[model samples]
Target: MHRFKILFVCMGNICRSPLAEGIFKHMTDNAARAGEFEIDSAGTGGWHQGNPPDPRSVAVAAAHGVDISTQRARRIAVGDFDRFDLILALDRDILRNLRKIVPAGETDKLQLFSRYARGIDEDIPDPYYGGREDFDRVYTMLLTGCTSLLDTAGKLRTS
Candidate 1:
């Protein structure tokens, strides 16, 4: 009866990570699989702590039928390493940063989000400084990646 816990990470929680969390949550909920997983997101830094996902991110997700409006920004906490079965980083830089903070023996939990995405960009670039299209592009990528992420998680559940 253990839920598979996942924590998506990026430079700031207001952007990439929240979108990932939202997309995955929305997908699971729609598939009637929400109870099988526990999903959340955080940033490598705490700059946007307590703030909701960026307006652009919220809008983008909303456009795609997913509401990320209520997700608040937070930093990658120490206990998260132990709490989550997977800690997925949106980009290599964030993955590297996560490596530095992950506690010993828990390193196996860390992975690049794009690894689930085959034949696509290896990083989900930050769209914080760009215009609406940037957020849209990231959304497309997340949709693709999150789909694969859920597939992988399902396999892990069975094995």
Candidate 2:
């Protein structure tokens, strides 16, 4: 009955991380596995804390039948290291930032999100300053990665 907790992180919670949180939630709900997961998103910096996700991220997620408008931005916290079973970073830089702050014994919780993706091995680029095409590209990558992550959750559960 334990829920598998996950936290998606980015430089700012407005763009990439929020999108990832929404998409993963949508996927889990669609599969009727929503009850088995606890999902959320955060940023490395608190500049946008308490603000909603960027409009572009909301629009793109809406276009894909997911709504991320209700999510609020928040900076990653030390408590999060203990809260989530997995802490996924959108890029290598974020991964490094996470490594620096993660508690010594909790280091295993940090990971690069793309590792779950089937073919993609690169960092997920920040699309905050770009146009719709940029958001679209990030959406595609997240969809693929989230699907893989869900597929692998059984292993996480067993472990």
Q: What is the lDDT of candidate 2?
A: 0.92
Candidate 1 segments exceeding 4 Å error: 117-121
Give the TM-score of each candidate: 0.96, 0.96
RMSD of each: 1.4, 1.3
Tens digit per residue, CA lDDT, model 2, 45-122: 999999999999999999999999999999999999999999999999999999989988999888899975555668
lDDT of 1 by residue, 31-78 (tens): 999999999999989999999999999999999899999899999899
Give lDDT: candidate 1, residue 16. 95
Q: Number of the top candidate by lDDT?
A: 2
| Clash-forming residue pairs, model 2 | none
